[model samples]
Target: MVRITNTIDIDASTQQVYAALRALDAYPTWLRHSTVYRGTKMRTPQSGKSLSYEDSTMVGRMRGEVVEDVPDHALQFHQRKPSGSLDALIRYEVSAAGTGTHLTRVGELTTHGMLHIVQPILLRMAAAESERTMKSLKAHVEGHPI
Candidate 1:
């Protein structure tokens, strides 16, 4: 298993940050190299219902499910191929910091079958991607040029 975490400061309110994170359509707007993110299923915000999205990236594409969402606080999910072989558990968190928000994203990837052969490389790539996305998200959500 490989795990990584990234954090960025957003000059926005917690609510605003949460809203951006909750909107599936806005993911690709901030996340670089993310070409697709369509919410096929979603639960009400109050119920903190699970949501599923299909994402396409330069490397490949996969389906991801939101497993946890705490308003103004955090969002967590598990991502995998449609075959359900490799898995990526991800979490996003927000905190009120002074007058802004501190956003954090954490992810763990586990491989099955022969995918383990490239686990190290994949982990490194994921870490780099996570950092890049967080920085872009911070700029985009904070109303800065991205």
Candidate 2:
């Protein structure tokens, strides 16, 4: 498994940050990548609720589902290739940081078949992607570009 993590502080309340996290449709406006919510089953993210969607990444379209949702606290999602060769886990932890919010993100990827051979490459890309996502998310919640 390859793991990568990143953190950022957004100048907004935890409620503000959590609201932005659940706003799937507004993702394309600030996210570095594209996550198509056109087919998402859960209109509102909540604990135990299933989330399903497809995202455009370096590896092409990938499907994912929400595995955990703790309102205003933590959120986690899992992704895997349609062919069942690769699995990825992404999670976010949110907390109140004075007048703003502290966000921590972690990403883990496990590869099967031939993907294991390129685990090192995936690690690098995942780290970069994680950073970009954090920065973009911070900006998105803070209501200005970072």
Candidate 3:
């Protein structure tokens, strides 16, 4: 099993941070490795409904389901991949920090089947990707013109 987590501070309010994070349409503007996104389902901010996004990554395009959500606080999901040892769980958390917001993103992978042998490599890759995603998100949220 591989677990990767990254946290960053954004000079934005929790609402602003959460809005940017939860919107699938905003992902391409923030998530660097998510070069392509399609088949997105989302709900209004007040609804607290479910949303899903199909993201294209270096590993391949995968469908992720929003399994957990807590308004401006957190979001968690699992990525479904077929015929691979990769089972992925991704989570994002946001909280107010002074005049800004603290954001954390974690991606965990469990390897099985024939992919067990490469668990280490896969874990490292997940770490790098998770970090990159956080950096991009931070840049997007903090860089917004006031």
- Residue-level lDDT tens digits of model 1 in 1-146: 87798888889999998888788767756665532332233424445446777666543556777788899999888778766557889899899999999888989988877668878877777887788777777787877867
- For model 2 the local lDDT of residue 57 reads 66
Q: What lDDT would each prediction earn against the true structure? A: 0.76, 0.76, 0.73
Q: Could you tell me how far off, in angstroms, the CA of residue 58 lies in candidate 3 after the best superposition? A: 2.5
Minimal lDDT window, size 10, model 3: 34-43
| Best first by lDDT, ranked | 2, 1, 3
Every model's TM-score: 0.84, 0.85, 0.81
Q: Give me candidate 2's TM-score against the actual structure.
A: 0.85
Candidate 1 positional error at 130, Å: 0.2
How far is 44's C-alpha from truth in model 2 (Å)? 13
In model 1, the worst 10-residue window by lDDT is 34-43
State in Å the error of residue 133, model 1: 0.9
lDDT (10s digit) by residue, model 3, range 7-101: 99988899988888778776754564443222344434336546666666555656677888898999898886565646788888999999999
Model 2 lDDT per residue over 1-146, tens place: 87788889989988888878766656667775433222222344456658666666666557777788899998888988887777999888999998999999988899988878888887777787678778888877777775
Which candidate should be chosen as best, given TM-score against the real structure?
2
What TM-score does candidate 3 get on C-alpha atoms? 0.81
For candidate 1, the lDDT comes to 0.76
